[model samples]
Target: MDINMKKILLLGMGLSSVFLLSACSWIQPLPGAFNVALLEEKDVTGCTKLGTTTSSVLSHVGLYDRDTAAIKKDLILLAKNEAVNMRGDTIVAISPLQDGRMEFAIYDCVK
Candidate 1:
């Protein structure tokens, strides 16, 4: 009923809306574009091994927990980007690290 109480309620609603919207995927940073192939160690026989690449995803505070699928997707994209930078066509021996990171050996294949 009071003006002060109404203002406080409005401010609280505004803050709550901000927090809720911030948790949406649309508000998050866009995922990078890198479409490198994921291959096994034996599959890189004829491919020239470039080097190893590592990537990670950090957890953030949100109304809902971070999506593991999204995290893995981003990690894969990060690794592929690294492979692309290395002039590789595929990433071999891909492995997940204990620290929520991914490691892969980059390779350039002549197919």
Candidate 2:
């Protein structure tokens, strides 16, 4: 390979490595994790239904692999954050969407 071609190849590889490393921490859990109850439909009797919310994780690049477990964990945390924002005590009837997203039915329960 010529000198110019070799330099281009090395730059491409360096950039690829950087992207891969950066993607590793994309789904990290929150510090001092807040507790948001995850409840079933039957368990929502005394709770007041607030509203529905959704969260999603998108792949950074086509070359990157999807981490389902991490995505799920992040989605749960996202829902919990939303619950906190809405001043709700629990999340009920949680469902996974066809895309890399989670749907949450939020509720404010009697504590």
Regions of candidate 2 where Cα sits further than 4 Å from its true position: 1-33, 59-61
Sequence-dependent TM-score of model 1? 0.62
Q: Cα lDDT for residue 81, model 1? A: 77
Q: For residues 1-111, could you state the per-residue lDDT of candidate 2 as single tens digits?
A: 999999999989988886666455454434422667888889998888889899887634455655666556667777777888887878864676545688989888866
> lDDT tens digits, residues 36-93, model 1?
7887898788988889987876534344344566557666677777777777878864
Compare the candidates by lDDT and give the number of the best one: 2
Q: Which portions of model 1 miss their true places by more than 4 Å?
A: 1-34, 62-65
lDDT of 2: 0.73
lDDT of 1 at 105: 90
Against the reference, the lDDT scores of all candidates come to 0.68, 0.73
